[model samples]
Target chain A: MTRLLPVLTVLLAIVALWYAAVAPMNIRQALDMAERGGAVVVPEGSRVRSETSVWTLMAQNTGEIARGYALDRPRLPTPVQVGAELWKTTGEMALRGRAFSTRSLIYHGWITLQSTLFGFALGTAIGILGAVGIVYSRTMEMSVMPWAIISQTVPIVALAPMIIVLSSQLGIEERAVPKAIISAYLCFFPVLVGMVKGLRSPSREQLDLLRTYNAGGFASFLKLRLPASVPYLFTSLKIGVAAALVGTIVGELPTGAISGLGARILIGDQFGTPLAIWAALFAAAILAGALVTLIGWLQGLAMRRMGVRA
Target chain B: MDIEDVVVASDLSLTFKTADGPVHALKDVNLTINKGDFVSFIGPSGCGKTTFLRCVAALEMPTGGTLTVNGMSPDAARKARAYGYVFQAAGLYPWRTIAGNIRLPLEIMGYSKAEMGERVDRVLELVELSGFGGKFPWQLSGGMQQRASIARALAFDADILLMDEPFGALDEIVRDRLNEELLSLWDRTGKTIGFVTHSIPEAVYLSTKIVVMSPRPGRITDVIESPLPKERPLDIRDSREFIEVAHRVRDGLRAGHGDEL
Candidate 1:
């Protein structure tokens, strides 16, 4: 609880700042609405005379500020509005009808999560294989490593559209595949780097000891290299999973898929509903947090089973 | 006692080709180590004592000349599982418990699980680390970690044990105690041991034969067979014979340094 104090304090500060900004950001729009509503006909000179500072304007127009905070289409959603939308979409929608239906945030969250997991698995496999190649073959180390580094330079946002278009041309209609490939593209690099480092981590003495035992290449790799790489693999997995989720969401954007969190964000933007956008953002964050935590738990179990400190 | 040669090195030379130039690590090293002999190679840094041990373990190939172990080439002998090597550091896999580390070689050798367990238990008892089988390497003190490493080498019951400065990192008191324990362990096992160290007293106290070596194209300067008995106590380092052997080792080291100049 004590450890959480600073985090809670920072969160509270951010929320307060968010609430404070609502008035100033929306004050012009609020006054425009008030003028349009014919509540007051303000003379151009009187606007400068009435309020010298934003704080004073805010103090004088509490009703207008409250109106800004309660806007259906806010520039920045307030914490309470976001929380209510989150509840409405995920909790209330699910409780009212089919839990996995179009109205539910849970449905969109699951769609994103499914693609993320698939991409994560594919990326992990490819990364481990790439790492093995790099470790064992000098050619792979020289060639593949440079290419892998170059691959990351191409931004995923730029690549996602190309991947989606190409896949669609190939008659790949499943929207999840392109997203998963994008995720795998993002996920593989960290695992490759971490595994390479991990596989090489055994000391010279340890390798020599293995040689003295007449342990062959494959034997040493399985017994020594693979086991040594576990901690590193899990560390990379946590990062990869989060990256995979981002890739999946980015994949959703260009295609305008109407099923996942990305679609919700797109729809929210189209309809000017800050609530939906905020809800989707929070849902993605929760998904990433839960996935990372699961990986961490698995890492703890594996390290403990091996008798190393977790 | 009629003895059989367990290790034979004739005109053994190893030169490492570095970017600067060729660094001669070992040269013209001729030696015959007999079965059941406790031989210690005493030398200063870069004297190639560790290099010689590595050759015997087949970890390094001699650039010139011949070296054989157990009547076979070093590589062949390695394939035959003729030896176990302990390093300067304990080098225990941190991820494994003491017993698991000991069980490693046995597992690699495709021993049955029952056999692996039995060997692990027996070596743990031999090293007096019986109760530490479940503990990871970091949990143990420096001496205990080294002892566990020794147990790991001893686990597969190889006829030859190659230890390279296994106690070099320990405090003197712990070193003294471990040295005594090692002698008893040697006496019990009767394995042909090739030990490496820089300490004259440690060399004098432990070995049945002390091979003093010199650096700069590392070669044996003196081979002194101890007149001391096989059964040695901790206070045996204070003995007159032990002192005489120690003095000879020190003199050999000094002479080797003089030759380098």
Candidate 2:
């Protein structure tokens, strides 16, 4: 309860700030609508209203300021507006048996999640195998590690379209294939660096102790290096999973891909519905939080079972 | 190659090639450790005492001269699992329970499931850590952790034991108690043991044979065979014979420093 209070307080503060900023952000549109309804707003002309400071216009037209919260298409949606959109698209649609329809955020979120998970699994496998190779062989360490680092510097946004087109040219029909590849591209580096560091974490004494036992290389790795790398693996996994989600979303952004949450965002922007965009953004945030928290919980479970204290 | 000799170092030397220069860690060191002997290498820092013990364990290669263990080359004896080594720190794996840590070497050496369990139980009892095997190393005190480490080394039942400052980090009261326990353990096992330490009294109290050494091209200054009987108690340190041996060790250490001043 004590831990929860601080988080709740901070969230409330952010919402309050968001609500306060909504008045300034959407006031001009609200005033224009009010003027069209024959109400006398202080700024006579739309151009003058655009030039005027929003704060001054706000103070001059207190009655019309509340209208900003009620606009059909707000410039910046209020928290309550975003919340209602979320419920109408998710909970209300579920009540009408349309939760998995094209309009529902859940359907889009599920699509995004599939690509994220596929990429994450692929990236983690490649990363761990690469780390083992790098740790055991000098040639792999010298050759592959620099290339892995260089791979990350090329922007994923720029590469996503090229990957999509290249995969299509190779006769791959599945849209998810290119997205998952892009996600894996973003996911592999953190896991590789972390596992490399983790695989090398054993102290000199620990290694010497193994040497004294004359343990074989495979035995040493399985018994010592692998277990020592668990905490590090989890840390990297958290980062990798988050990066994978971003890569999946970014992959959806290019190519007018009309399925995932990223597509919903693009659709909302094109239709000029700020509420839908805000709701989709919030859904993505919630998904990322859930994935990272799930990894953290798994870490706790593995550590506890291994007799490691918290 | 006497059958009774467990480790024989003749004109054995090790020079570590550092970027600064070659460091002569040991110089023409000759020693013989017999079967069932408790030999302690006593010296100051940079005196190669721990290095000599490491050489016996085949953890370090001697650049010059020959060193043999169990009548074979040190490397071969190591492969044969001739010796169990204890480091300065306990170096227990935190993820494993005490029994699990003790079972590590046995598992690596391909002991059967039943034998591994049996040896773990036996060594835990030998170290008086029978009940604490289920506990994690971090949950135990420092002294208990070191005891668990010793139990881990003994679990494989190697004939030779090499310890490098195994109790150097403990408080004196804890050290004294562990010293007594270690003496009893050595008495029971009759394993050929090579211990390294800087404490003079610890050297005098525990070793059947004490090799006093000097620094700067590390070499043995004196080898004292204790006249005291095999069955020694902690109170034996207060005896006249123990003090006489300790005085001789201190004199040897000072004589090694004579050329420096």
Candidate 3:
């Protein structure tokens, strides 16, 4: 409980700041809306409102500041508005057994999760294979390592659309495939670097001990290197899963997908519903937190079974 | 080489070609370790004692001279699994239980599951770690961890055991206790042992033969054949014969250092 106090405090501070920022951010729009409704707002012209400082306008119209929190299209959604939208989309829908409905965040979250998990698995497999090759062969280390690093440098935002177009041209019917590929592309680098470091983590004395047993290359690897890399692999996996989610979300952006949290965010932006975007963003955060926490729990379980101390 | 000779090194030399210059880690060192013999190499730091042991285990290549273990080259003998080596540190895998660490070599060598279990149990009992086999290395004390490492080396039933300062890191009380346990272990197993240390009393207490050496173009200065009895106790360190052997080793070390000063 004591450990949780600091985190709770920081979260409270952030929420307070978010609530405070809402008034200033949406004040101009709120005043303009009030003027159109026939209320006499000081410095009523939209052009004057844009030119004047939001803080000064806010003080001049204290009565109008509360309207900022109730705007139809807020620049920054209030915490209560976001919380209400999140609950309506997720909790309320879940309670009504409509959690998987088209409008539900859970439905969109499940879509994003499928691609994220698929891409995570693909990236992990490629990463482990690449690490093994790099560790065993000098040629792979020299050839593949540079390209792996270079692959990460090409911005995923730019690459996502190309991948989508390329896969579609290749006659792939599944939209998830291109998204998974882009997700895998972003996640594989961390796994590769981490596994390479992990596979080489055994000490000279440990290697020498294996050598004394006359253990062959494969035997040594199975007995020593593979087991040694587990802790490192898990550490990389946490990072990889989070990156995969980001890649899936970015991939969702350019494709104009009709479902998924990323689509909700894009659609909310296009249709001028900041509340929908805020809800989807929070849902994405919750999903990322769940995925990372799940991996952490697995890591603890594996280490315990392997006889490693915490 | 004699029929009983387990390791025979004549004019064995190892020169490490560092970027700074060539370092003569071992210089024309000559020695013979026979079957069932406990030979300890004692010297100050940089004295090639550990290097020589590494050479016998085929972990290092000798630059010059003929060196053989069980009548074959060190590398060939290594492939035949003729020896088990214990390093200065326990070097047990943290991810494995004590029994599991002992089972590592047996698994690599493709021993049957039942036989591996039997060997692990036997070696754990031999090292007085019978019921603690399921415990991780970190859970055991340093002395127990080293004993478990010894058990690991013994599990394979190799005829030769090469230990490089296996107890160098322990406190004196722990070191003394482990030394006594090790001597009894050596007496029971009758394995040809190559031990390395810097402590004069440790070398005197542990070996049938103590090879004294010096650093800087590292080479042997003396080979003392101990006259101590096979059945010895920890109190033997205070005995006249033990002190005499230790004194000679000290003198040999001083003589090796004579040219340096």
Candidate 4:
């Protein structure tokens, strides 16, 4: 409870500040809309306030402030508005027998999830293979590691479209493959670096002891290098999974895929529905959180079984 | 091809070519360790005691001369699993249990599961750590961990044991106790043992022969055979024979230092 209190307090403060900013941010548009509807309009820049108090100024512009918070297409959606949209898209939409419907977040969330998982799996395999190559061979370490680092510096947004287009030309029609490749590209570096470090983590004494046993290269790798890399692999895997999700979303954007959460966000932006964008953003955050938590659970189980403390 | 000479090094030299300069870690090192002999190499920090031990285990190759173990090349002896090596620190794999650590060499040697289990149990009992098989290396005390390391080395029942300062990290009381236990273990096993240490009393107490070494191109100054009886107690350190042997080792070390100036 004590640990949670500080986090909850900070979250509440952010929500309160968000609510307070809604009025000032959208007030000008609200007043202009009122004027266009032939309502009484206070031109605030031309008029001087009788009292400099904030409450008095707010009282004078109550109707306009209310309209600002309740705008159908706000530039910045209030937390409550975003919350309502989420509830409507997920809970209300599901209750109304359209759980898998186009309007439902659950439908779009599932679409994004498939690509994210595929990308994560591909990234892990690439990372492990890259790490093993680097550890086992001096040539691979010298040649491949620098290129892998250079690959990460190129922005995913710029590269995603190129990858998608090139892949399509190569007769790869499935949209998820390119996205998975991009996700794998994002994730592999951390796993590679971590595994390399872990593989080399054993002491000289330990290596010498293995030498005395006359253990072969493959036997030593399986017995010593691989088990030693587990904790490090999991740490990289957590980072990789999150990066994979970001890669999938970025991959979705340039392709203009209309099925995933990234597409939902792009659609909401085009229609100027801030609430729609915010809901999709929240859904992506939730999905990433769940994926990372699953990795953490796996890490706990594996590490515990290996007698490594959390 | 002498059957009694378990290890024979003739004019063995190892030079490491670093970016700074060539470090002559061991130079023209020649020694013979016979079967069933407890030999301890006592020296300063850079005296190549560990280097010589590593060469015997085939972990390092001498740049010149010949070094053989069990009447064969060190590499061939290593391939035959002729010796078990215990390092300075108890280098137990943290992820493995005490029994798992002990079973490591056996597993690599392709021993059957039943044999591996039986040997792990027997060695654990031999080391007086019978119930510690389930515990991780980190869970045990430093002395206990070193004992576990010894048990690991003993698991395969090899003809020779190479140990490099196995108890150097422990407290004095723990060191003394482990030394006594090691003497008894050596007596029981009859394995030819090469131990390296910095302590004079430990050298005098544990070995049938003590090799005094000096730094600056790492070579043996003198090899002193112990005049004391094989059956030694902890209180043997107070005896005249033990002190006389300890003084010879001290004299050999001092003589080597005087030659440097």
- Give me the runs in candidate 4 sitting further than 4 Å from their true place: A37-39, A42-63
lDDT string, candidate 3, A1-310, tens digits: 7879999999999999989999899999999999999998888799988889998999899999999889867989888888999999999999999999999999999999999999999998999999999999999999999999999999999999999999999999798999899899988989999999999999999999999999999998998999999999999999999999999999899896888889999999999998999999999999999999999999999999998777
lDDT of 1 at A36: 69
Better of 1 and 3 by lDDT: 3
Cα deviation of A261, candidate 4, in Å: 0.8
Local error of candidate 4 at residue B86 (angstroms): 0.6
Global lDDT of each candidate: 0.89, 0.94, 0.94, 0.90
Q: For every candidate, what is the interface RMSD in angstroms? A: 1.1, 0.6, 0.7, 0.9
Docking class of 2: high
Which digits, one per residue and each the tens of the lDDT, describe model 2 over residues B44-126?
89999999999998999999999999999999999999999999999999999999999999999999999998999999999
Residue A304 lDDT, candidate 2, scale 0-100: 97
The superposed Cα distance between candidate 1 and the true structure at residue A143, in angstroms, equals 2.6
Report the C-alpha lDDT of model 1 over B1-261, residue by residue, as the tens digit: 123999999999999999999988999999999999999999888899999999999999999999989989999999999998999999888888888899889989999999998888899999999889999998999999999999999988689999999999999999999999999999999999999998888888899999999999799999999999988887888889999999899999899999968
**Candidates 1 and 3: which is better by DockQ?**
3
Error of 2 at B227 (Å): 1.2
Residue A144, candidate 2: alpha-carbon lDDT: 100
* Model 2: per-residue Cα lDDT at residue B98: 95
lDDT of 4 by residue, A95-135 (tens): 99898999899998888889888988888898899989998
